[model samples]
Target: MNRFATLFSASALSTIAFGADSYAAMPHPGTEPEQQLETTITRLSPSAYNVVLIESLRDDHSEPPFANVTPQSHEARLVQASVIANPALSRKLQAQNVELDNIVGAETAADGSVTFYLR
Candidate 1:
């Protein structure tokens, strides 16, 4: 029937729209950045940098600040906190000697790395 055809079309479009995205659907991404001590921050320009948080860091449940965020967003926020609290990113900042403060955005890779853009 026409309704069935409409449903099939909608389903196909939905699949195509979402199928291309590679981020994992992590329902119970445990913990915050506590155990995740490793992170990388690379300067993209004078005022911007990128932070990379390895997959293991994102394998835990979300914390308070990041509690309501989706898994991908959770990773981004987690990395920011992890690096600041964990020391390596702070060291990188000290070495680079720049004050980076704002979190612009974040992206997840299928290969287990989440990169955050900061300004």
Candidate 2:
């Protein structure tokens, strides 16, 4: 019985040592630096626009060419303009000029990409 107990104790110690070694080798989540999101806008057409979000490691500068330029998000906005006038035989229809509002939608991805939609 004493020999069996010794064997059991040795097995448990080996398991614990193996577990501790693996845990030490594993990378910690806090070791990685935080990423920042950058947004860019592109005009697709006269009434359509595309916004792209990119994740960057640096806060002041963004390296798209060499760095890991992961696209985090994408957003599209459509602009509509119309004229409101009463129906009249003599009245000429005039198109109303419209401007885009300063409203935007944004989303973030797990990889650190951020997408923004502007209208």
TM-scores of the models, in the given order? 0.29, 0.29
- 1-119: candidate 2 lDDT, tens digit per residue: 99999999999999999999999977676442121111211211122222332333245565432133222222112111111111220022112121222213334445443333332
In Å, residue 86's CA in model 2 sits off its true spot by 61
Q: Tell me the lDDT of candidate 2.
A: 0.33
Query: Candidate 1, which ten residues in sequence have the lowest lDDT sum?
Result: 37-46
| lDDT of model 1, residue 25 | 44
- Model 2 segments beyond 4 Å from truth? 33-109, 112-119
Each model's number of backbone clashes? 6, 1
Query: How high is the CA lDDT of each candidate model?
Result: 0.47, 0.33
**Per-residue error (Å), model 2, residue 109:** 7.7
- By lDDT, the best candidate is 1
lDDT at position 24, candidate 2? 91
Lowest summed lDDT across 10 adjacent residues in model 2 is found at: 81-90
With a 3 Å backbone cut-off (N, CA, C), the pairs that clash in candidate 1 are 29-60, 29-61, 30-60, 30-61, 31-60, 31-61
